[model samples]
Target: MDLLTARIDLDAIAHNTRVLKQRAGDARLMCVVKADAYNHGAQRVVPVMDASGADAFGVATLAEGASISELTAKPVAAWLWVPGQEIPPGVELGVPTLDHLSWLIDARVNAPLHIKVDTGMHRSGLRESDWEAAFRMAARAGLEVKGLMSHLAVADDPANPYTDAQADAFRRAVALARQVGLEVPVNHLANSPALLSRPDLAFDQVRAGVGLYGLEPIAGGGSDLRPAMSWVARVLAVKPLSVGEAVSYGLTWAAPDNGFVAVVTAGYADGVARSWQGCLDVAIGAHRYPQVGRVCMDQFIVWLGDNDAGVAIGDEAVIFGAGGVGATELADRVGTINYEIVCAPTGRTVRTYTGGTGA
Candidate 1:
């Protein structure tokens, strides 16, 4: 058995895709599979999404787009790339700036392009001042302008007014693109959070990212989405700790009494962040144990508290997943988001898939 594993449920992915597609209504569902499907392994999840209801795929880099272009016949659009990078064939491009547009035009890139406008995020995409100019330039260059796309800054908070402001800006960009002779068909602006909360902003397509992974983007918003990934480790060893005796580096935590502690296989190097020390609760069978002391590079100690459940070596210890704390709850404990929690399993963490056959 693998010492550490990120168990991915492909059926959950398919279920989430179908749910998002149904929620999208008339708008097309563009499943965002960037960062290897948020570290869920795009190579596998993409097919599940495609088989379910994903109308298209979206990635952050050209390489990522190219990697999964053949996975589905649906359009694959990559939005994050530098100007001089070689554009991959068979993949759509999101033009984030005038310079990127100019580069594409100069190179005569034949890929379908989505003009990324800065509605509110202000991280990437073309500024409002350059929208008209860029639109006209693409029109003049006879580029295949697929549509307009933008990012929502505060879509996670449904009550945030900035989402409304950004939606208005996105509408203006789409209108201006059409005014400048670009058909601007299939424009999209709503991300997972917006797509879940604001159907009004789902203009032409909805890019569902984290939601496709069964994570609710809105805080305190419960949905039918089931989490797909589980970070689990094996109990390497269980030993007794005397009172006043400590465990792990710095001996930051000691046994509250004469209780037992279990050595878990996961550590910081296995994507269990060092900062997660003292905050994580590992679940073994029916019992929950508090992780104590400094997190090591290859292992950590979880106080089993008298080994009531008799957690033994090789027993599966769920760091976060179905039997343990949920990703959202773990994120709340670690001062992060569920997105990062799902994406954290790396290094020695091996990925194992389950429920992919549609059973």
Candidate 2:
């Protein structure tokens, strides 16, 4: 085992996917595999995701789609963030926001795709009026409307009315498509949060991204999902510090009393963000350790106790895992999303994949 390595629980991936599969039912669960399966190693996780019952995979770029396509026989939908006049050859396309009909016409040789509707997210997808038009245009262009979908702008917010509104808009759009005689086979809308919290939105299919990894989007709670990634680094060096001695760069953290500071063998260069600052926490056995001072490019110090508890050099330090310390919580500490946290593992860390509980 390397000093710094990311332990990916392959079985947790399967478990989460099974939960998602149950929620999604016969509609098929589309596991969003963009950004290297949220940095859990798409190459490593796709096969397990396939075995866990993911009917299809969704990617942000054509390259990502191709990369995932090689791993599974299931259909790969390439979701394009930016519109181009032509679709890439040999890959199925997923348009983020269905804008123009001509774009689909230009990609005549590729497979069909699902349309992204900006129900209330205001990020992508076709407008309410354009929804029906886009579907008709896609069919006219010989593009099969594999799915009609929209995104929940605030599915994580239980009190937010936007989720309900998005659902209404999505249903309206689907009705309009059916009225126009378009074969809208699958109608999906909702991400991890929606899939977990708003089960009713699991229409014909639901895109499970973070939830498939067992992390709830909302801070407080949600459905049963197991986090599939665990980050661990070994304590490299331990040093005694006098009271009032500041640590790391910027002199941000000062020891109030005599204590020990242990330098961990990982840092921003390893994808542990410098912004983690005073926010992140690491663990040894059952004790919690605070990250002291500013996180450097390749190193960060943790405030071990003055009493030399049980942590020692070469002792494994768990950044997050099990009972609460998870990728989702790590992201929350720095005010980011779960996807960022999962993918934050620097390339330097050896990725060891295993199948079991407690990823």
**TM-score, per-candidate, Cα-based:** 0.98, 0.91
What value does the lDDT take at residue 241 in candidate 1? Answer: 88
Tens digit per residue, CA lDDT, model 1, 1-359: 89999999999999999989998999999999999999999888998999998899999999999998978888999988988888878999998888898888888788899989998787999999998899889999999999999899889999989999999898898889899899988999999988888999999999999999988899886778999999999999999889999888887887879989999998888888899987899999998999999999999989987777778989999999999999999999999999999999999999989987543
Go through the candidates in order and give each one's C-alpha lDDT. Answer: 0.91, 0.78
Report the lDDT tens digits of candidate 2 across residue range 1-359: 69888887888889889988887766678999888888788877888888878888888887787788888888888766455534544456666655444555664545677777778878767878777667777767767777777778778887898788888888888888878777778778978887767778888888889877767777686567778888888889888999999988899889989988888888889988887888778887677788889898778899986745767789788877753377777777789887788778885788888874333
Q: Tell me the lDDT of model 1 at 39.
A: 97
**Residue 207's lDDT in candidate 2:** 88
Off by over 4 Å in 2: 81-90, 96-100, 322-324, 356-359
Candidate 1 residue spans exceeding 4 A from truth:
none
In the order shown, what is each candidate's alpha-carbon RMSD? 1.1, 2.6
